[model samples]
Each structure stands twice: as structure tokens, then as C-alpha cells.
Target: MFMVGRESEAFKHCTPIPILGVACYAFGLHLLKTCGIMRSIARADLDFSYITSRLAVMSQPAEGLVESAYRNHAEDVRALLEGRHKGHYTVYNLSGRRSGALSLHSGDATHMSGGNVVDCPGWKSHRAPPLSALYTLCEVMYDFLEADPKNICIAQCMDGKASSATLVCAFLMFVNMFPRPEDAAQMFAVKRTPPGLQPSEM
Candidate 1:
């Protein structure tokens, strides 16, 4: 719900445009620009059951299905369903022989570099089916929330800006489901450091 980065006059000018194509580009740039501050937010969590049910419905085996099973310590498909594990789950190495289950940053960063003219070492990357996989991950997180709404779910990246954006997106989804400002405010609070960025960031 909160974000922070170096303020730039260019971003101030560019943010108001309504075009999707331009907006996506600007958003990425904005994240890159705001690489210093560790932005964070608190929200009404998620409905874990709803998410798990959705994933259950979309049960299709993919490359990391076995790894997923292993990560959950799921002896059987039913066990995987019944388990309470959730929140920022990861599937380890799928790129090569040394591959195992790793969180977003734990896997091989080298494989992700796709012919970039400039090599940026220590920068993490991975290929995720953004449309399908992101939605599925959201659903799973929702299920985790439904299981226990009082429990807080926190996600962050190494840089923190991208994680902040993702947290906002997730919070917006929850607000759509329960449309009450007071309810949301009570459920979640944007926790940003330096306290100056809270108003504009959320």
C-alpha cells in the first residue's frame, strides 16, 4: 500500500497518461527509479479457501509439478490440497541439472539473462507464465488468507519496490471484494519507512 523512490520531475509529468502500453512501460521504469526505499503495506489479507479452491479447479500438471509436490511434502494429490501451506511459494531449479526448489531469488540468475547487450550481475530473473501463473499464485495466496484472515502475509523483493507494487495490486483485489474504506483501513495499513511516502504511495 506504500511505495517510495527517488522523486523525479520526469515521473511526475509522465504518470498521468491513460494509455495501457505507455503505462506498463512507465510502471516498470518507476519501480527501477524507486530502488532505495523499502515500501510496504498492510491489508485485509486474503480468503485462502477461495484461492485454494480456484487452484484446485485449475489443476493441470506442468514442468514443476513434481517439484511442487516435493516442496509441499505432498505424498499424494489429496495431501497437497488438504495442507495449509501457502504464501510466496517457490519452485526450485527447472532450468538445469542442479535445479531444485528455490524461492524467486534462489534459482540460477544466469539462465534468465536473455541476450541482453549489457550484463548485469547479481540481478535476479526468471521466466514465469505471467498471465496464468500470476493469477494462480494470487489464488493460492487468497486461500491462505481465507484460512486465517487475522494472519498477515508479507512479500518483498530484494529491491522492495516491485514487491510494494505487487502488494498494492493484491490489496486492490481484496478491496474490490469488500468495498468499505473503514473496513479496509482497519484491516490493513500501509507501513512505509520515513513516513513521508504513505499518502502518495498508497
Candidate 2:
């Protein structure tokens, strides 16, 4: 629970803010800003489960559902639930060191775009990674979202910056139905200041 990019000074305005510099301080600030609790004695703890629950409460899907499936081989997954339209609990991991699953199901006919589902005819785009690669990732993402639309999807890389952001932005545009990659990027930037723009490797 490292507060990767929260500058300590950001919370200076909050009275009686913790000087301990713990990651939970950021969560407190967020809660204070959104929940409007001054003299904030009882701090709210936000772990993965808390976030997942909050999203469910707000009718928002969980994060990382899409990226998890994309990172693994599809056939390796063991779908906990299966439907003609989609499948769920798709667990897969090649190395056996760490295993993961997509918790949702979607109909087979639906194509994922921008963090949402769409039809083939409507899936139009000219971008890097090519359609084949994009479709494969979309299928994985769709499975997770379909299983539980309110589930959160998570992704990570060594740096936990651009690579993670790329996958997230991809899901935002492809499955979440975000209109533009730039829009997705801006959304991420709000949470964390992004590094300098770099040319796409592809």
C-alpha cells in the first residue's frame, strides 16, 4: 500500500494530518476530500477488498479484471462459471508460481472496447499492437467484466508506471468504452502524475 506519487505536501491543508507519512495517509486525504469529515479521528482503511466493495456500492466495476486475463494464456483458465455468452472464475497462470482469475462472464458475441463490451461491426480502430493482439486482450478483459461487471481489474509491472498504465488505458478504451486514449490517460494522471510521454515501442 505504497502511496507511490502522493507528495506529502498535498495533505498540508488538512488539519491534524499524520506526519508519520504512511500510505494510508493518502486514503485519509481522499476520504476527507470526498467524505467531508473534519477532525478526522476514525481513519478509513482501503485495501483491495475495500476498493472492490466501494465500487460495488457505487455500481462501478472492479479494476484489473481485463489485464489479468490478457497476461495469461486463455486455454489455461478454469472458468468457475460458464455461459453461452461468457464465463467466470477463469483461473490461469503458466508458471504455477502465482495463479489468478477473471471473476466475470460476458456473452461470446460481445467485443470488449474501452472497458466495455461492443459488437464486431462497431469495433473500429487503427492503433498499435494490431487488431489480432488487441482482440485477444479484449477477450480476456471481457471475460472478467462479464463475470462480474462490478468487479475490479488490476495490473502490474516491474516499474508499476507506464506498463501498468498502458494496459489500464487499453482496457479503458477497449472495454470500458472510453472515447479516447488521451481521455483515459488524463483520468490516470488525476490519480498519479504520469512520467514524460515516450514513443510507443510498437
Q: How do the residues 117-159 of candidate 1 rate in per-residue lDDT, one tens digit apiece?
A: 1111221222222344334444444444334422222332222
Q: Give per-residue lDDT, candidate 2, residue 107.
A: 21
Index of the highest-lDDT prediction = 2
Model 1: lDDT equals 0.27
User: TM-scores of all models?
Assistant: 0.27, 0.37
Regions of model 1 farther than 4 Å from truth:
1-129, 174-202
User: Against the correct fold, how does model 2 do in TM-score?
Assistant: 0.37
Candidate 1 lands at a TM-score of 0.27
Residues 1-202 of candidate 2 have per-residue lDDT tens digits of: 3222322233333232344344334323332222112112122221111111111101111225574433332222212112211322222111112222332333233333222221122221122334464556545754554445333333323223444455455544453323456655554454444523344611
Residue 44: error of model 1 in Å? 23
